[model samples]
Target: MAKKNVLIIGAGGVAQVVAHKVAQSAAEFGALHIANRTQSKADAIIQTLRDKGHRMPFASHALDAMDPAAVEALIRQLDAGIVINVGTAFINMTVLEGCIRAGAAYIDTAIHEDPARICETPPWYGNYEWKRRDDVAKAGITAILGAGFDPGVVNAYARLAEDEYFDKIDSIDIVDINAGSHGRWFATNFDPEINFREFTGTVYSWQGGEWRENRMFEVGREWDLPVVGKQKAYLSGHDEVHSLSARYPDADVRFWMGFGDHYINVFTVLQKLGLLSEQPVRTAEGLEVVPLKVVKAVLPDPASLAPDYTGKTCIGDLVKGSLDGKPGEVFIYNVADHKQAFEEVGSQGISYTAGVPPVAAAILVARGTWDVKKMANVEDLPARPFLELLGRMGLPTRVIDATGDHPI
Candidate 1:
């Protein structure tokens, strides 16, 4: 098969890692192009690739990803066969449309969000991306949603349990613990606006064959994970649960994320004061400003945390089910070190974890392993291939079963 040209549609921290990973595997791909709202940001990524002595064909462009016409034009200009969208979640639908129109395979790390809304309806994919399923099928182009670590790899983990370890699945509990510290007073690991938006609304989980809603930080549990050790995680809504529940309807699906007391307190203050609202409010000077955007503007960019970031992150799926007509459980997970990620890709662990998997998915598309040519969530495809590819590409998978801990 001919190599596919790849285009990355964001210039954020995750995009940096994506660029590096793609360059490292450039021989498997054709030309690489990156486009962002700021061309300089894209250029910086290309410069980093060049600094690392990657001589792949690379170019950068300034783009308004929200505009489908602009996105389609860029894809056509490059004849990009695969588009990796590490861009903000707000641009997902538009970028996906462009890919479909340009006949390019589409991949994104998160579900799409409306800039003016937070935590809209449930089966969130149905509210946006899945609405375009017929269009993607008609176009006959592969579209993979939520291909990041939590949603991406975790989705694959649940599938792995179904495929290899379970007869009848009972539950999938995804735990995300970031034991890393950026040495900052307070900062989000990714986009502050997006991060805050995630918690400002209702938390949704799939339980009892229905969507259950709760406030962020309302439900908590202690997880004795691998590298991160014992940590407290709160029940939270996430991209993987929606799709995973659909695939394993009999299984209860829930996502839990670790948060320090400091973060919770600060988040509570900001949220209570309406500082995290996506809706605009008038200032004393009558300037219309979005409180959340203003707060985001004042916070340190998530990309800047890499240099001082130290520690590790443990994220995975703890699956429970029946095997041989008996109860059983397995924890399928990965432990990523922030400093190691910085040394390798100039990105912190959060970005590194979220960034690497989409590129792996892209490689599968290029190699025809995951080129299903339809709109599918990560779990909709085969699991082992994706996990094994991730293992070779820096994020190795481990599992704890009745037999004990071992590599997958």
Candidate 2:
């Protein structure tokens, strides 16, 4: 049988990495197509591929992913067996519906977010994607949620702990430290609307066997990691914590993100000024616009930062529990260099790390290893094959414990 076609939504930094990686691994897929709200952005990504000397058959389409009919139409037109939804988190449900209606496998990098709401509740997956469990199952399709780094590989790390290290996991502290710098005075590595919204809301975590709430940058601790050295990470709300809590309720699951003092100061100022609000307000000219979106518009596009970005990122899960009835802890992580990533895929390390995993998941689905034909979170799937494939694709897994830091 001919390889299946894959359709990727969104034309952002992360999507660029996905497009390039998928193009590199073209033999595993049929025709590769990428769509975005603006066809120009999608064409830009295709052009980047051409500039890199890739000779695969690639196509670009204009898609408003929020419209399920249009999305389904595009999927059908492309004959795509797999739909990678890397668009804004707000379009997840609509894109998921399209995938189901079109009989295509669905994958996404983050949890769905309402354009109007900041933080809804813990177990974020239970709020949106989990509601479609029956729909995905009845359609006999695979839907992988949170295929990005934190929710993606970090979730797999928890599973790896269960499979290899510990008999009972006590706590899972996911530390995401982007030690890389994009050489900007003030800029987010990803979409500003999503990035600012994440910090403006109440930070929710799973602790003490229940849901706990805290302010952004409230609780923090210094961690001496492998490459990044000593860095302070603040407890933050994230997608994996929600699903992982459901999977391992007995364990206290929390997400900690490292932010430099400058970022915290800038973010605090923006929040205090009410510039990060998602609600629409009338401007002086009597036109309504969402402040967060306006801020996003003013911010540098994340993709544009790749050329000047330097340094490395260390993201991992520090799981503490018992092994053979003895106390133990293991840190499963990956260290990615921005320069190396930009050299490989015209995007920075942050994008490259987040982008590579879904393609790995897609390859597994195409290979019949992860095509479970059911709705699943990253943790719910088997861990070994996905991690191994990711290692080969660029983001290799490393484990540090009483033994030492070694590749998986």
TM-score of each prediction? 0.99, 0.98
Please write out the lDDT profile of model 1 over residues 193-303, one tens digit for every residue: 889888888999999999999999999999898878899999998888888888998889999999999999999999999999888899899899988989999999999
Candidate 1 regions with alpha-carbon error over 4 angstroms: none
Model 2 residue runs over 4 Å out of place are none
Q: Quantify how close model 2 is to the true structure by its C-alpha RMSD in Å.
A: 0.9
TM-score of 2: 0.98
Per-residue lDDT over 113-149 for candidate 2, one digit per residue giving the tens place of the 0 to 100 score: 9987878976778889999999999999999999889
Worst-scoring 10-residue span by lDDT in model 2:
116-125
lDDT, candidate 1, residue 193?
A: 89
Alpha carbon lDDT of each predicted model: 0.94, 0.93
Summed backbone clashes in each candidate are 0, 0
